[model samples]
Target: MECWDAAVSSLSLALMVLAVAYLLRQTRTPTRYGRYVPADIRCCSARLGWLVQEVPSFLLPLMLLLLTEPDTEQPGRTRRGTGRKLLVWTFMLHYFHRGRPVPLIIVLSAAIFCSINGFLQGHHLLHCAQFKDTWLTDARLAAGFLVFVLGLTINIHSDHILRSLRKPGETVYRIPHGGMFEFVSGANFFGEIIEWCGYAVAVWSLPAFAFFFFTVCSIGPRAYQHHRDYQQRFEDYPRSRKALIPFIL
Candidate 1:
């Protein structure tokens, strides 16, 4: 392997390790954001937080796309062509998960996470990935694409369901119904997990796979915690529903 390959592999492995650490930390005490916000912490407006968290991920890929040289062997394809494709599709996805005031620590940490992910993904795609001319027709790619679409749909719909639950001036948290919430307490998290898993499958790269692994480990506990919260909060909560994965987790 070249230096780039070694670096990326190290990054991928590091992400998985971080995932384990995050899972353990979150399991003992949940993240201090959203419903679990601590009594006293620095915070900022949700809009500003979203912008900060989302911009690095978006901009890094965009810059890579603009700066990377074209692949000489491919006639028209640039080194970061795949990054461009991803950026366009992902731009819309980033805007969906807005929220109330967010803790400053969470916001900054999330931004750093996104930035590192953006760098890893963009760099690998630009420098290391190789594809046959027939890659578009590869069964794995096609199947992964379908799965990614399905996951994205579920994620957006689940977010909608959650957002719709609370009306203006309503301070009480109501049980979210409909969508994947019928089957799993953390439908949104589940959808996100599916998205990254499918993304890993489609990309078929070490970085992508590591990202997927990290995503599962990190969010799986959060979903379970949400499930536990629901059960404790409402005695009438659906006992049949799982935490994240439908009928399983």
Candidate 2:
């Protein structure tokens, strides 16, 4: 099959998934106060209220960075359908729950950027549909999948450990252990960075590079904040663990 034909096929699948998600949201029932918010969202919002409060603190800086970015040059290097699948799964598992403003903003921003870039790259792939898929492309895709899976594991495992830690404790600020917690204060952020960096390698395009750049720009400071908090909150905090990396900061 032609490259254009395959790209179109993949993009069609992505659009279908989006349609399903929209329909699901539309079909959800309203609550007693006439709010359409789901229980999971409410729970998440309550749990992460402090994070919501912190969004405005970084808004000005983020806007400046995004506004000055350039467009992709070699868009054909990106795979449309596969990227969308990764994004859709990310939202379904991680972002679908109702959280406070920070998480909601993240989901919204991610959705917008992913949709737009995916379409642009997909269009490029369709335009170059006559090109053949080489063994090198297959290898890149496999590598991308492995990186994404590893990232997913890191994210879910760390989150589970943290959640479990909070269950039996009444303390508002408690240090967590196990999983990647022993290596980095922001293991979850590290996982997400890994995920996007892997994406950049897989797509091997300017758009993916931009996405990873944005991810790092956004999460890097948060990791630093958490690292500082850990040191201040616990006198016994390990000095060996870096902010976001294992042994290197």
Best by TM-score: 1
lDDT of candidate 2 over 95-170, digit per residue (tens) = 3222223345444444454454444343433233222235245777669767867876787787677667654535
Candidate maximizing lDDT: 1
Give the RMSD in angstroms, all C-alphas superposed, for model 1: 3.0
Candidate 2 Cα errors over 4 Å, as ranges: 1-131, 135-137, 168-171
TM-score, structure 2 vs. true: 0.57
Candidate 1 local lDDT, 1-249, one digit each (tens): 122888888999999899999988987899887888876787898789988986776777667657767665564334334543663344335444665678998898989988888778767776677666666667987777778788888888998888788887777788999989999999998988888777888888888888889889887888999899999999999899999988888
- Assess each prediction's global lDDT (C-alpha) against the native: 0.78, 0.54
Question: What is candidate 1's local distance difference test score?
Answer: 0.78
Q: Which ten residues in a row have the lowest lDDT in candidate 1?
A: 75-84
